[model samples]
Target: MRLICPNCGAQYEVPEDVIPQDGRDVQCSNCGDTWFQPSTQMMAEEAEARAATPPPATEAGSVDAAHTREDALQEPPQDAWPSAPEPEPAAAEEHWHEDPDAPAPGTPPAAPPEPEADPAPAKRRLDPEISRVLREEAMREEALRSGRDSLETQPELGLEDLPEDEAARRARQSEERVARMQGLDPAPQAHAAPLDRDRLDPQPGSRRGLLPNIEDVATNAPGETKPATPPPADAPAPPARKRGFSRGFLLVILLMALAILVYSNAAMIAESLPQADPYLSSYVAWVDQWRLWLDAQAQALAAE
Candidate 1:
């Protein structure tokens, strides 16, 4: 079956059953992002899994599946993701700093100052009035759902469990009145369109990948999974080696040189700052002043 990687738009495939069976983790071959998405069938299976389980089990399973699936689907592509439309610089790209990976000069990597850590989780918003309404609505909907569902299952329910006829009639009237004011219930849910994201990645020696953006780091994997985080801007980097002369080294050298120059200058200044004898000061001053005076006197005498 052909699958399109969401990242690179590359196409690839795997045996149909292996998809959910191997676990729904799919990634693009062109890039190395891994994400999970329940195929329509997988979703149905999930729903069935939910219905068949006990209430507590169903809740837990739903939460786990939801979390896993959410984490799984956000795969990055196989090839270079066109740099995130490079955020419009707060300043220009020139000031943006550069890296070897930079498309051109400017937009370089900021010096190895640590890249900011992963962003914190997004905050949830809750408004008091709105939250109150939502809570009430949720409670009402939950009651409606529970009431509707319990009607089918609980055998112990009695006539007393139901509303009084007059109250029921009044409630129906109020509901109808409110329904008329609001819109009608939404139409039945429609089938969602099928989406398949899978692609090719190049193996170390081979020209092809099992998938584009993701590959099985487990060579057995159709390919690797997408990175949990996007690869650092400096990723796909060559192996690490001992630092020879990084900026730190240059900075150390500069500091040493500055220290030497400062020390030398300080020594000279220190020697001068102490008061000198008047004779020495005068003698030095006379060398310059006396020579000029004598030359002037000779010139005047000669003129006379």
Candidate 2:
């Protein structure tokens, strides 16, 4: 029987009897693939026919022949049964196939080839609007790097942009605004009425200080003498003289009175007030010394 390995495509020839009628496990010699080798109906029938055929006729048996016949007639020992033959080596280039209508025994159905993997979808393209925005941003950055001022790149902001009336009104307002701040009203003036020298003191050249008011002035007609103004009864009077003794006269009198009183009461005061004793004694000593000096002068004069 012909056999082929599905994995390595290695072909092999094996005897039919080697495989059992039911099925036998077989391994590929080249690829070592193991599969169940099921026998075909034809091979099973051939095996049965061979078994049914009678054994060849033998001549008169020798002792060894009779023993062999008896051994055959009796069931052969389990060890004596024929073992399955090894598979023959496969040729490299050779291959075999059975008729499609009469499929080979134990042949597995062919597997369909796997579908090829599809290429990864192309990366999604960027939206046009987004790409445009990115480009504009890049341009703006490049402009800044080149040191171009924003005012030059953008629209101008000037008076030219304003309406004529608005521009004129703004200019007038600016002119009205004083450049220098107004100083505080020349150092706040007093709330009282202004003073006039002529009105306050009507009479002139009179050194006597007085505040004669304008009501003192009299209006007279031509050829008529004006009546003299009567002096105000409430006018301020002269200051009275302060009566007091002169400083020199008062001092001299005070010294005389003190000396007379102190001498007259010296002994009595010293006895009654012990604190005054020292002062009184010192004063008495000074008077006595003076008297002695005067007596000595008088004596010298009399001698002269």
Please give the clash total of every predicted structure, in order. Answer: 43, 0
TM-score for candidate 2: 0.22
Give the top-scoring candidate (lDDT).
Answer: 2
TM-score of each: 0.14, 0.22
Cα lDDT of model 2 by residue, 1-304, tens digit: 8887888989888887787778788899898889887887656688999999876555434656988888888985666678897766575225665567874689886788999999999999999999999999999999887776444555645634444343343333332332111222222321132222333224344423332222322222233346689989999998976656576788899998999789878999998999999999999889889889999999999999
- Alpha-carbon deviation at 250 in model 2, angstroms: 2.4
> Taking the tens digit of each residue's C-alpha lDDT, what string does model 1 give over 204-270?
3432322222222234333343557766896688888967769789999998797556544553654
